[model samples]
Target: MKENIDLFTNLLEKKYGVWNRNKALFGTTPYGKVASDLSISSSQFSKLLYGTATEGMYERTLNNINRLIERQSIEKAYEETQLVINKSKTAYRKRIYFFSILFLGIGLITSYLFDFNHFAFKLSDYEKHPLKSYFYPESSMFFDSPFIYNNAISENCPCSGFEGKWKLSESFKLPLPGMKKPGLYYQAKSADMIIRCSNLFDSYIDKGHGMMGYEHLKSEIWIDTKQEPLVPQYFNPSSKVFTESFKQLNFESDPRFKKIADLAAFNVNMFKIHGDSITRNAELTGRLAIDVNKKLAKKYNIDIGYIVKNVLGDLIKASCKTTFNPFCNPNDLSEGISKISFDCVYTINEENLGLNEGYPYTKSYLFKDQVFSDYLPCECEDN
Candidate 1:
């Protein structure tokens, strides 16, 4: 392909010089003039250059080129090619000088209008109106220290490097391309704020994976006294609220996550309730796929199990779009219940979860799986 293109280009340069991709100084492109002479469309001539022309066009163009080469002697062709080369070099030098002057003039004017040290646009303004920096670069020097992070941590947070310059929560309101809305709206001095701003390491408090040593607040708190381990133990499920609520969570009807949920429920309950009795534990663990305490399965129905699975597995899968490491243990289940109730999945921004809008997970196998299909919508129909 390269050889074919090169042969065509070398021949073209010998006859008509380089094909100016931009406008020709006269009227039409050199390629266009040659294409017209050969009775082929400019596009067809281009295709021939890249060896992408149809068989008929390729043959016709080759025949025309052979005749064209034969019409002129090698010495004449060489002399004509030298003239075109000299002209092309002059034009190229003129373009370089023109651009250099244009850029220099623009830079000097920008510096004069808006001092480099004191830009008309503050980082705070850029934080609030992010696009202003790009559109009006003269005003907003967004690359500066404070403005470097378009979306920094909350102003209320002590760890927020920018001292009271910007609010992390405010980023949700801005209509930036890849910016995602926060899961929980943070209010100053509020429980949500305290919960969000307590983190010193990362910008936001991520679900399941928070920085070590930080007392990252969970949505639900464990019951002070342990009751029936099989029963739903977490109290105050509605303590945390999300900016957007989760909908269309078909846990029971969805077989994949349901099976995982049921197994998780059985495992947690069996571990907690029958851990003391080795014989009972082994028997119950074996029957994980089948059932767990038929009397309890019937009594409470699948509600407890569904809740267990929804929080630990379904919600986790939905929120962590990139990675799907679900927790099914009692502690994680309690946190999961909180996540489900507060709609935590939507509260955390997509950026916080390491999601790139340009490269989405909609087509990924994890997204296609029936378990997550309801949570993460796919671009194509499921197989």
Candidate 2:
């Protein structure tokens, strides 16, 4: 695929000079003009160059691209191709859904369209507002340093040379297209700060994997800044109160961490109680011509659950990051602070466990068995 891409691009460049995506778009300087031809702003366009773009593309659109480019690479042909590219980019831009920023009116970045759907707060004003930065990047900065990480995920951390930044390539579940990175290891300090800080990390409990049942599968803890003093009175869970009470998260307090522990305990109990039901009803509401025997599928699914649970338990060796966004956000989430989210699958050796291979095999088989989707296969076979 990359070869074909290079070939097509080389052909265009041969006809025209080095093809400038920015010049072809708005016919202006490279700085802001890159975003003008399409819905992706200048920053996003740059990130695309940075190889941090998402892997969402349409085959129809890709096919249409061939017809749109200049055949001869002549000046007039280039103009025509440019117009076609502009239209194509704009068409693709409409499909994405960005998370909304908290301060909508405050213009933070270069383009309005790019920053429109981001969850951003002023780096300076963050003490006043709370953010769930663990799930997604903030509008301005990421909390780093003095992070209290569970011992399960923080062994021999930061690896070797990767100290300056927390979010490194080593932690990525799936590496992005750009440069390779070394992981940054964060350590928690017993300092003047409290459990929660003026710095905030996002809190979102993602539901179970396909047919895995609805429970929080991931628990992420992103460092914000120096912790604020722990205040027990602010235990309320409102949005505004979320900000004020953010300081209540205490690292030393065993009871304080119980909220997270409860989530873990709940997941374990659900697995025990509904283990059969989850595997049994993986494919639900599908009417079949004949009754499909799900005994084997149920067995495979149960085995797969163990694989996942064990893998989740193996966070000790994997990089302690929850998500991997290499470059800064369109709205600049880093606020100049190096950002990295810390998380763990917990207690397993990656070399010993072929969970890498086991994961894909288990996940795929379940889907084929209709364990993750709404459709049911008519025939069930023994593998």
Candidate 3:
């Protein structure tokens, strides 16, 4: 039991990252710090510091110390093990749920398009055969040969190095059309996609090789394109309170940080506005579909000229309007505005519009018709 207590005490010191010392002889500095922090007395600390062999003292103090250490170790181990188990279980459940939903969605789509007899025949044939059924009518297109739909799928090509797919390759040659020069271009894909590397000895170091290696390749196209600022409004910097707040944030926070918090809040508001606009447009489009009258147009503010003028972009002209009917059809609404860029109209001035001193102007754009219709009640009016 004496040997066991000594071994246990040694183990406790080693496990807890603490020092092993004689309780009575040790200076008050270390023992006093521990006792003060732990709310234990000198004698109590001494028992843990140098365990005893007597049954009563050993059971009461020494055993309790061992039990406490053991409990901590066990609890830590249990938490770590439980975390791993929970993560694995969650992943397994997600995979099962995903595949089940995918299969179910495919089944529903198949059932909707094909008759029962054809569907059952195809299913049975598919179950029995692999390669032959792979090229079947309905299943062949998206499920069997997804590459047909997604043409970008190719052999382990050079582009993968830049895009982060291939890691072993030292460098990649971009196949830019009509480029006089071709070589590895080191840049980040976007501002949001910068790579960071820390000391290899650090626990937080992520050393996985691949796109992670080429994460430094950032995209600065927005800088050159000179795209209209998303939020061009100037925020009013006139208020003493606001100026102080701005100073506090700018000085204390990270230097690289942009004033994105306000931009994010503005974006959220824009999204809400856009969502409301879409709902109103859908209602207007439905009304137009049934009756294309002047009253309906007036009520919904459906200016045919505006729609025609808005859809004049090169991409929009090439895609939706060219192939689809009614040049500006209602059914083609989904595909038409999928990629339209709406210029944001509002501005935030940190200072009074007249005083441009401390106030910085932010430029923003919203997709036209994406925000609440021009007819909706203005929230600013309420204010």
User: TM-score: which candidate is best?
Assistant: 3
Instruction: Give candidate 3's root-mean-square deviation (CA, Å).
Output: 29.0
Per-residue lDDT for 123-174 in model 3, tens only?
3232221222332335434564311122331221111111211111111111
Pairs that clash in candidate 1: 121-139, 182-347, 183-346, 183-347, 183-348, 184-347
Cα lDDT tens digits for candidate 2, 318-365: 322223423211122222243323333222343533222221101101
How do all the candidates rank in terms of lDDT, highest first? 1, 3, 2
TM-score: model 2 vs. ground truth: 0.16
Total colliding residue pairs, candidate 3: 40
lDDT, candidate 2, at 295: 49
lDDT for every model?
Answer: 0.30, 0.25, 0.27
- Summing lDDT over every window of 10 consecutive residues in candidate 2, give the lowest-scoring window: 360-369
Tell me the tens digit of each residue's lDDT in model 1 across 1-383: 66556656666665566656565411234666788766678788778876896654553454355435434554578899988767777779799789999999998998899864355233212222223233225654454432213244322222221111111121111001111221111111101111112222122222211211101111211111112221122112233221221223222343322121112111100011111110000011111112233443343233434333322222222221222222222122221121211111321123323222211111111110010111111111111
- Candidate 3 has its poorest 10 consecutive residues by lDDT at 261-270
Model 1 regions lying over 4 Å from their true place: 24-29, 74-383
lDDT of 1 at 181: 25
Candidate 1 least-lDDT 10 residues: 275-284
